[model samples]
Target: MDHIFRASRQWERIQNRYITEDAAVDLTNLKSDPRNFKLSLWDPTTNGVRYLKTLAYHLGMELSPAELARIRRTPNREIGDPTTVRCGGETLCMDYLQATYEVGFIEREIDLSGARILEIGAGYGRTCHMIMSNHDISGYCIVDLKNTLRLSKAYLRQVLDEPRFKLIDFIEVDSLQDDSLRSERFDLCINIHSMTEMSPETVRAYLDLINETCSAFYVKNPVGKYIDKSLDGYLQGQEAVEMALENGPLRQLLDIHDSQAVQAAVPAFIEGYRPGDAWDCVGDSRALPWSYLWQALYKNPRKPSDG
Candidate 1:
């Protein structure tokens, strides 16, 4: 797999930086522990079904029978359960359901038939596989730490065909500033659950890159959790949005609170049917200020002269 999914040395530096200094637990260790890793655990059937239903309600789009069938067929790449959710005799993996929800949401907003997409923190390529398999994207780039991308590349290769796989390009974090990246432009940039974990400076850097490279962007992260003191201070969700509005070359189009999903998830979380640390309602802004999905759609700002 290493032979098939190669990484540049720059990826090594980024991986090291995250492991040694980042506030979150070492991703390498997290990747190894399937039981505790949030990505590894599968949501309950009830919660899973509710998530899909809620997303559909918000987007005003329903999943086709064929689309649901495809999701049921996609096996779980992570360790927990090959069949994460069993609904009406159909089995679906956690990643499959999540990817379906995310892709379905995006499809409602934009036609990704041949869009160029840049995804920061493509965990094991769950969403990547779903999007590539279902959509006719022209190009898809995954930018993340070396080890993380390695997992994604290997997992994706198992499910994606050669032609679809060929569309993928892996970019190391250290090379984010390269002329190649700066010159390139994308239809959309996506970051989910990653920016909230990063320092504000790191988040700002990525925002800068997204502004320079993409016409639109989507981010879904927690509202408030002061993970890094030096960079973000006490800011989280809305604060982050304010900062982006002030500095980034983009404006908000939508911001939806994720309370629906969070509310649906709380029951399973309380039952210990869900995985990872229990969803703590205390000390986390995501819960206190009404847990939000925050589907912020932003487009590049027009030049002052054009306006």
Candidate 2:
């Protein structure tokens, strides 16, 4: 299988260099051979935009002038809760990524029950709701910028009314070092799509803080060898991550590292999900199903001091 995969890659290079125009059209005739289709999909040189458009058209998604306008105005903000948002034309809904990992977490039974969970980028508290709703757990806390914290508090209050769930709360702090934040500790820390919002220095600082104060941590982010320039929010380079990790404070706290596939949350498609003050645009925000969710866990090796 290794040799076959390698040879397949080599043939793709040849096709990209020598054959351009009729390659896709010709390949359709070769559909009987599954490897040919796989090779085409894997070809880096193939234009993904064209490919995706072709796929969408084949799936019978037609856009009228009004629908196209709706898509155009659809704000690209994070959907903390998909159930509340209206999907104008997208085929999939929320819970796609959440459900997959829920089963995985359950099978693993990794002891999330009643843990003092912390989610870094608790945008509108959707992921927070996932943890609190699904797992058998104790309490969860959210740390976010003042703007997001305000929006999340409002959203949660409107959407839910249950007593047992008081285990969840929101905190507003400037930097993690704000006297209020530094004085506290949590059992687990989570960072969803929030890492990209900060500078490398801030990421390292936050990681160090988590290491010193928290017992365990989880992060789901995009990292690896290949850099896809076309991604909507892909990192410019890997150095930001490297610099953060190499800095001493982050190095000591984390024990294990795991990389999981996260769907890149495309804000362009979501209605009402915007960069503006979401609180001000409550009824008017456009949102699309954002696919970015990664889960990485860290175990605190040294016992935290009982201060």
Candidate 3:
């Protein structure tokens, strides 16, 4: 039963920080915090922003001044108390801009019109909002840890109108069972960088769920391994544990898995796991360093063994 669906210590720290800052005017400006630079669209390096802008243009956003103005008009930039900067003649938050690019990533492969989608980690509902804005999807669901779930709820409530908001479901991660997931089948399931923060078992459980029902899925995560580090910035693994014993920070390794563990779940033998006609799946360059688009398939529903 997910064995409590344990999250790695690092993610626990991140969620706890969000919970702790639930009241504080949150830091959306990249320059506000050094730690924000990693693991979140809430912050992006200068080059990352540049790449995002370039991607957006390629996706056809900035082809004209009106298009740029339209992008600037999107609510993601300032909604939910995020700080934004001026870029390419538009005021933007890297988080919001990054979300736009992600929605575009999925749209090119699948038609989101009336799609019933599920997102594993909806960071403050950024991508959810972006998807709803760009498409006329029937519904959306977000399953995540408690802290992040709360954040998404608060943000989505304000951004999405009553009808659209009511169509959405927010489930806690632990509540999604193996045998019975949601009442209705989903069209697509998405998981961004959050899986890199999950324990391997947790990641597989989610994949198993998607395998059971979703028509398709999209994933963007770090390239290899789910090596967790402590909040104090000490890497956690067998090597880390050894360091702890040998006069290191005394932080022991946590139960985690290498990236290959996930690859095992989605075997290349399965057509659903295959890359698009011309898409380069090993896209460490676009998402982030050592990060890649692991898989985005018009899923075939069941694994080969299900036959």
Give the candidate number with the greatest lDDT.
3
The C-alpha lDDT values of all candidates are 0.58, 0.47, 0.59
Number of the top candidate by TM-score? 3
lDDT of 1 by residue, 140-209 (tens): 9999988898888888888788898899999877766546588888887877667655655666677677
lDDT, model 1: 0.58
Considering summed lDDT, which 10 consecutive residues are worst modelled in model 3? Answer: 247-256
* Residue 110 accuracy (lDDT) in model 1: 60
The model with the greater TM-score, 1 or 3, is 3
- Over the full model, what C-alpha lDDT does candidate 2 score relative to the true structure? 0.47
Q: Count the backbone clashes (under 3 Å) in each candidate.
A: 3, 18, 1
TM-score per prediction, in order, is: 0.55, 0.48, 0.58
